[model samples]
Target: MLIDFRPSGRLRGKNPVDFDSAVGPVLNALAAGRRDVSRMRVACDWVQYRENFRDIVDVRPVLPRPDSAESQAGQAAGAPGYDVELAVDVRRSGTVALGDLTAARLAGDDLDGRVYLEDWGLAGQSCIWDFNALYWSALELWEKASGRGYEQALPGGESDARNRGAARELISGLFTVWDRLAAAGALPEELYVAELGVGNGSQAKIFLDEFRDLDQTGERGYYRRLHYLMCDYSQYVLDLARETVVAHAGHVSSVALDATRPSHSLGFLRGKTFLLYISNVYDNLPTDEVAQLGGRPYSVQTRAYFPPGAATELAASVSAEPEELPGLVRRLLRLGPALLADSAPEHIGDTDTAVRFWQEAWSALRLEERYVPLAGLDLYSLAPGVSGEELRPLLESGADVRMHVSSGAVASFVDSLPLLHPFGRLVCHDLFVTKVQDYRVGFRGPGKYDGSVVNWVNGPLLAHAGRRRGFDVRFEPFRHRSGGNIMTMTTQPGD
Candidate 1:
């Protein structure tokens, strides 16, 4: 029998999965049930983080098709038995839970049909994003109820974009580029720079403030001709950002637009923008995870669910039935907190109560994941113009692996690329997994950041997509901060 165990480093000093205690009993049960136990393979994936799913021991029967690599290998070795995939979360399951899961599996309780709610499609299309959108849409209420701003939840309680030194360096680089253009008499009358996901506007304030000061000192006059557009999906964030950059009102404009489809709202600026800046945005965008296992590709499907106990508690909090929770959640996602309050006043008395419900629901929510085979890469769409073929090289780069597609990021990148001037560039700083090996080392998120979802943007995949579009894409460690996961990605016209 083949036993594959993937252990997490987080549980150092502590046994993440004890072979004797956890695997021995399961193997014994399997042997007792089946005569051909020697032909079976058991693969275990253990994670230390709490995912959106609540399953302690998720066991799925892996039946490789006749055409699959696994089956072919088994046929060659004269081993025809099937495989079993076991996924465990140490954060939620203990030794007793593992034993119970083993007994349950022996009793033919695969736990595949058991779910708290309906499947939400692929991970990217999950209703979690709807909750994310509602979070941004009702920022004020969330912040008031949480007693802290979203920015406060970041690693350093702020973004590195606000670093004055980084802003100064970027301003210097822009001035040098603009000076050369000015000398050639190629500079446009109105210089343009846009910042996407302008969180709280502090980054814009730093950039604009530095640009104005440097331009005046250098006598470049670029500041006066500059047009700074602050674009974000949330009007609430835009409003807050507008207030933060009020000093540069003459040169700054707030645009309430979706970051994933910037071209839809800023199409007029195509090929006119000198610089497009993004920070901590791509990671927050929706993404789908794909896994290459047994030489076959599979899409990760997810379903948002509330644990039975939590669901019961949540229902009681809102004075409703557990069956009604899904409808309420759907309603909350469809309508923002304030609207939900007005729409379901009988359940949620006011906006404050609605916000409380949102928080409680968010806390209780979990995602159940399963792997579904893909027909072909061409049939998959990463974004509108981007294809799943872009993920081919990365997925097949090494042994079996799983990585995010960053569908939303790719869409935003593709849409924003056309906005750049011939001599312009796009720069983004966020949590980027630059190497495919990195995904194997640790969890790359789908983790929560305050009220939003975050997954590490697949930097190599983005680079691949950029190169295909006649652009040079590169990533460097964020120069502003010494210790952090943030990486700087710059894209410009390729030679």
Candidate 2:
């Protein structure tokens, strides 16, 4: 048997995992059972985030032989395979979790009452995104109630795009390209530049402000011909951004569109945009995660849930029963807080009360995870045109590993690529896991950032996709920030 332990920093001083209390009890229970358990591998991990949910003890087969009796019985029983590999979550008290595991194992219970919500398919397709959309759509209410903006929750309390140095560098590069195009008499009549996820428009303001100032001194004449587009999913954020760049109103336009399918909305700008800028947006988009264990690929399926106790408490707080909580949460995700309040005035008295409920629900929300086998890589689609074949080298490159497909990021990247001019470049600053090994060492995320999901983009897979499309993709640390997770990804037409 192989045992692996990956504990968080907080667990360093104390015993991270108690083998006698946790592992020994489960092993003893299995030993007493009819099933063979001699070949099992055990892994224990401490999930640092309170927002994440993991089973106390999870068991699965690691590459079961096809002709083995265990495999046949697993098929007959509708089980994935023999539970040969066990994963334990050390977040809960070891003895208590082991007792629960042993009790369920011995009694043959399905562990039903622990689940507050039913399975919702894969993590990416779950209703979490619905809540995420509602959060952004009704961001004004969230910010008002929290007494702070979403940007304040970021590592530096602001986006790196707002850094004057970074903005100046990007603007300078654009000016150089525009200058060359103009000298060659190939510049378009209307110079176009687009910024996606224009949070508060501060980044746009800085870029535009610098562009105008630099143009005045250099006499590039590009600022006069410039058309800046501030694009975002939230009209409220767009409105705030518009006010921030009101000085350059004539030169700017606010576009309310989905970032994942920019081409669907900005098809007119195909090959017209001279530069596309994105900041801290891709990570928030929906993504599915996949993992490889013993050369077998599995998709990480998840169901968003509230713990039983939290569910009862939340329901009681809203004057509802625990059984009625899912429907109410569904209603909250479907409708913004205001509409939910308007729709269910008895339960949620006002918009403020609704917002509070939303906050509490978000705080209590967790994800239960399981692994389902992938049929094939070629059969999987990362985006509309991009294939799961791109994930092949990454997954098989090393030992057992798990990583995000960054489905939304890839779709956005592929769709937005068509909008770039021949000399255009796409610049994005966000959380990126540049190496596959990173996923093996620690959790990348599905962590909550205020009200939205945040996952590290699969940078290497993205680079592969870009290269397949004849674009050169590269990643580097965010130059302006020291000791940050943010990486700068630049995609441009290859030579």
Candidate 3:
């Protein structure tokens, strides 16, 4: 059979390895060795291509330490370390290319620790979305200073005239569902609706306002019975949302929690919620992408990089010796620009300068991609003890599967199912790519949006995962907006 190769990374056809050709010998080897043959095997050897990459795999001091200012200053004054070639192990399971591995702090570490990808020409390539998740943890400070985020500054404001029409479409559907539940005597004493990523709370106000209007019609007192839970990772956003929805305070409750791991924070409402509402949140959560090359699947690896000449002055302060870039970036995010400068005044200047430097550095960040062959389908943990084979439908779509493996989205989506009553539904509106063809066109994003990461979610993958869990997943174009790419995903029980 002739093979078709789908290169998720930039290095397409540079290495013409076939999936079937590469997999069969490995399978045969496993069989001869009396090993399990039910796994997806991959064939790869570290090719000696010295020109494209420098080998620093054996460098000393794999990570940076929290040294004194004087010590870091002395290190930064030294010559830069050479970049290395590091390949992480890929197991039989279809996981852990570069994106699945937790980031290390240095280049010579067990895993490739460098964060800047532009130097390696991997800038703008697709990566696992976890970096974006980490990046948002720092935005609470930025938002405090700027008083804005993705939602507040969303193109034309989230509730603009055009967007309001979509809100109506959303509420109309909710009205229909509410009517069905009330008529069937299925509406619980306290009807639950949880909105993840409440943002600036305008969406909640709009939703609550609409619900109140619907309640005025005297259908079944659903509005009075409504218990709306606003959930978000940022306390800053949550507090703001609470204020926005102050008029509906009696019906509203706020939960500061990670949208990805909703189960940990939302376990109290298991099977009690009627609707789990999410808007533009899933796209920001952590995700991993996988691609099939010549029929054999490979997980994509990514590292962050700064573009040349973008933030040269600030970049110079970051240690390029023991590879202090990731560590420095982490410190900058965690401490904020002021504290970071305060802590390292020897080189990083003062608060105002540091803040400016931070913005410059952030805008310069990019991504690099590398594809790693997998051993089989056993290593990826979809659920406890579930094999990666369960995800094949999502990955092996015949065309090159540049799948954004939104593990967080899957976790949140699956966990939220228990949050819903029998007839309850989970409704989410976000930038979603509902087909494989969408990916073949280009990389969706890890787009920087005012200190936050905005990516078009892998809709097809999430739908596939939802189906595996016995839920009906459907995608519809957002009716309120005409030009933007917002799609609504409504999931309910297949039964």
| Candidate 1 lDDT over residue span 33-64, tens digit each | 66455544455545533534445556544445
**lDDT by candidate, in order shown:** 0.81, 0.81, 0.60
By lDDT, is 1 or 3 better?
A: 1
Model 2 alpha-carbon drift over 4 Å, by segment: 6-41, 44-50, 53-112, 118-120
Candidate 3 per-residue lDDT, tens place, 58-110, comes to 11111222344633564477522211222211122122222222122122233
lDDT, ranked from best to worst: 2, 1, 3
TM-score of predicted model 1? 0.89
Q: Tens-digit lDDT track for model 2 on 232-266?
A: 99999999999999999999998999989998878
The model with the greatest TM-score is 1
Ranking by TM-score: 1, 2, 3
Q: Best candidate, lDDT-wise? A: 2
* Candidate 2 local lDDT, residue 427: 97
Candidate number that wins on lDDT, 2 or 3: 2
Off by over 4 Å in 3: 1-149, 157-162, 178-184, 307-311, 316-326, 382-387
